[model samples]
Target: MTPEQILPSPQRRQTYWHTALALAVLAAVVWLARRHWPMVETGAVRLAVADQGWLLVAGVATVATWPCSAFAQQGAVPDRLPPGRLVAAQFAASAANHVLPAGLGAGVVTLRFLMRCGIPFAGAATAIAVKGTAGGIVRGALIAMLVAVCPGVLLVPSLDARYLVAVCVAAVGALALLAGPLSDRCRRALTALRAYLGAVHARPVRAAALWGGSLAFVALHCVALVAVTRAVDLPLPPARVALLHLAASTVAALLPTPGGLGSLDVALALALTAAGAPAVAAASAVLGYRLLTVWLPLIPGLVVLGVLVRRGSL
Candidate 1:
């Protein structure tokens, strides 16, 4: 029998894609561990000698983020999604997020899950945008508040006239609204996102879930980072540590890094150092944060991702 006749064309194609996905996931894991082994090692050593109670708190905060994320996601969509599955999907999405730049992996996983839950492609995309918008707003607000509270923690470089370059960049970007290659698609997406945001907010309970969940998600992340700092005994106040993390993470988000991997590592370390932590201690704290939040959850999250894919839940 011919190969196509033996296995059938569609089944053969599906098998190939599945194999590719598995390999990709494995390669990503290997690359992440190998690339960041030094930091991970430093973090582990620090945690070993540091406070185990704070370490436990960090771990708990890390785990809580997934459920908060699911809550916000559910609010973004109009349908009543299964809470357990939503939370599991968020875990899988978080793992996938570190594999691709600019959050593509997480977005794809979530969009697929929404599709599985009977949302059309456009609606799913819009829901994602609304959720993203809510998260962004919460982060921005927190950043503003932190800046007010912690005046010199974030070193603001002196105002230089060269800063006008930013103005020029903004002007050029504004022009992208009218004539850039993706201008039309960008406009349409914005319009749809606005409409979706309004629709989601129309229901008071949904609005609460959306904003409250987003706030919880960000706060949990800050708490995790702060707890890690405490675990590693970084000489910084908890509120200050939280502020540094918020600012550094916001900056790192602009770099298109996968889950802000290298960018976040650098940013967090620098932020900690700027806030009076010794270099070695700051590095240890940043590594500890990554170890708890990213690397540890990764394998189990990937397992869940595979199960979801196999069951057509994503």
Candidate 2:
């Protein structure tokens, strides 16, 4: 082989190592967490999952979120890929998030899968970017509304000042991105984003649909959280539970720990305690939610990835 052909490209090597390191981290976290599984499972958990009715509702909610989330991502695409294939890609991506660190595995997998399906990397990236951006937007709006509408309910004295300051800083940053010279910068960013989407799909409506779908998908996730809490007979109000869910989920996404495994549990527990839920209940609720959502998706996603690779699609 030619010298150039024999050597791995730096970019490809970096991607390979990045994926390998991420997978290793995810596996280690999963192993450690499993060792503590018994501690996480208490009598309350049995009682919680025993509510077959609500558990079923939660399952449906989780499943429904997948497609909606996929659509939101699809919205960022300029045109639509085949719906069946797109859905499969989303499921596979879901699986990646379950097994990988910081939820990046799935995003990487999604980008690759779509690219193999003849989508441009730029468009696929844009679609993913839009989905992520939309999620941030949704969460920010929710947090702001909570602070405004239920100040007493959510405003802990210790956190309130920090929270407000953070919001102000974020607002200023957002404003800078949206106006004056920043407006041109914003357009450039969006234009780049659009280019990525175009690489996947050229149709605007399809991209919009995906974005909308992604939002609905996230909303379904929140519903699943509510359902899990109800199944456990937790007495937390729905709105309160939703807010906690949002906070924990966002934090989990930010965490470098695989699938936000440890971070997710801790975040949920803290959010619950902060909101005044009993410790045991908070832990159980978080555990139950992760069981249905995170752990459940990994195996299938890996399987799909294998299948796609075998089919020469990824």
Candidate 3:
């Protein structure tokens, strides 16, 4: 049988979508590199002048994301995963998340962790999907609230056609990539998503944990960026800084870039500069934000990942 005939409709659709998204993201990455290659050495002064106290606040918010992540992961399924292992899995998952594009690394790590906790493969995969859905919904709700409260936020940074296209590419890239983890058993995945999704929502504590944890996870990340902007004395208010981050991340989150690395940085910098921060200040804030959230935690998260693997907790 032909490949198309062998694969069912949903599976075939997913395959085609992943292929197209991968190509678009590859093009976007190359374009980003060509357009904005000079990033080092331009923003060091702003960092040097930043307030140390606000920087510490940013770091604290970044550190708190793992516990929120663990809570959300737990709420997605009925099985009670060990708390310490769950938190460590989340931290390590962050490291792995930055290594692979489109959240694949984190998804794989979570799947393994859940399975290691004695959940079946179908249950584990469904839980991951449930968590992702909750995260997306919470993010969208926050964006709506931020826009309502802070009108004129999310200024469209300079409106170049190239950038508009790049943003579109990133925005369309997430769902298909998110589905990749379950592509091997598409029908079972869908069935489980439906079955466990209802069960998960029907439980009061689970629903609360799922949504509440999702809120904290997204909100803390925004708080980290807001703190970084404050540290560098970026002129925008905290509300606007938080709103800009929400807008930029929503646009860039789906891109195939590892942790939305290049694409998100570009989006964030554009938004910050458009909001009247000088280019150097914007770059500095982005650097500090990444340093607090991604770079500093990466190695330790990886080490935790190794321990988890050695201990067979994953």
Candidate 4:
């Protein structure tokens, strides 16, 4: 009945809510991941792992993505961040990315890290935008280069022209609708993004790091896929397999699914199939790729996330 005991403190209530939300999200991601697990044929996974050497190479490639991501993130901002903590933050962000759609979780984690490093909110947002844009450009460029180098390696299914036209029209309409109602905050964000780009261009080292790291990040991912394909004994040439991965992953990025789960699996399998891989081998390769990229590291990544959170790094 004491006055001090009449109500819970705001901080305590906020902590309780945050913990509840985290548990709920964790449960949901676990359920979804479990449901999707069956898509990776267990037999194929077993066979793929039998080639321990290739599997090890694939794992190394997968682990390299963290430092590449850290480099790209650092390049996006002029402010210096502690290299060790920066890499740890990227590792943690990967785990967080699995729990939210459209990369929101990773963005939240990175934004917090940037703010903690003394970047203002707008600058942090702009840096993320720049990094993402650089990544997309590099991916597209790689796909184009690969397609040119190995013409006919990728066999994109023909789509009806009318369907494409309809998509274009819909996109235009959506943009028109949004243009008329552009919020002040969005306008400011756009301005900030432009300024950041100018600054990035002015700094050659930063620009090189941003572009180089983005390119390396994507190339490493494709190499990892090639490693998996090799482990699975897929007959496709490594170059072709890498190209297929780049194309499929680029398409899969549109899905906005957490870590591109179902969408990426289907897209990659179909791409491999189109490139003349045996159906079974294709499935096996995809399974192996995801095993190395997602399932295997998930636990450790989550552990890193928890450690960073406890240490107030994220």
TM-score of each: 0.81, 0.75, 0.79, 0.80
For every model in order, what is the number of clashing pairs?
0, 18, 0, 0
Lowest lDDT block of 10, candidate 4: 39-48
Tens digit per residue, CA lDDT, model 1, 208-308: 89999999999999999888888877889888998999989988787656787777877887788878997667878887789899999999999999999
User: Which lDDT tens digits does candidate 3 get at residues 1-314?
Assistant: 89978989997887677557766776876786566556534565668778999999998999999999999998998767799989999999999988876888899999999998889887888789889999999988888898899987755457889998998888778657866885668877577677888898889898888999999999999999999988987888898888889889888886777787777888898898988888878888998898888889989989999999999988
Task: List, residue by residue over 1-314, the lDDT tens digit for candidate 2.
Answer: 86458656985575567567656656765785576666466734564555778878988998887778667766766555667767777787777776665667778877887787677776667667777877788777876775665556555446677888999999998887668867777799878766665654566577567556756876788888888888877778888888777767776665466677666776777788788876666767776788788777768778987887687666
Candidates' C-alpha lDDT: 0.85, 0.72, 0.86, 0.82
The 10-residue segment of model 2 with minimum total lDDT is: 41-50
What's model 2's TM-score? Answer: 0.75
Local distance difference test, candidate 1: 0.85
Which of 1 and 4 is the better model by lDDT? 1
For candidate 3, the per-residue lDDT at 172 reads: 70
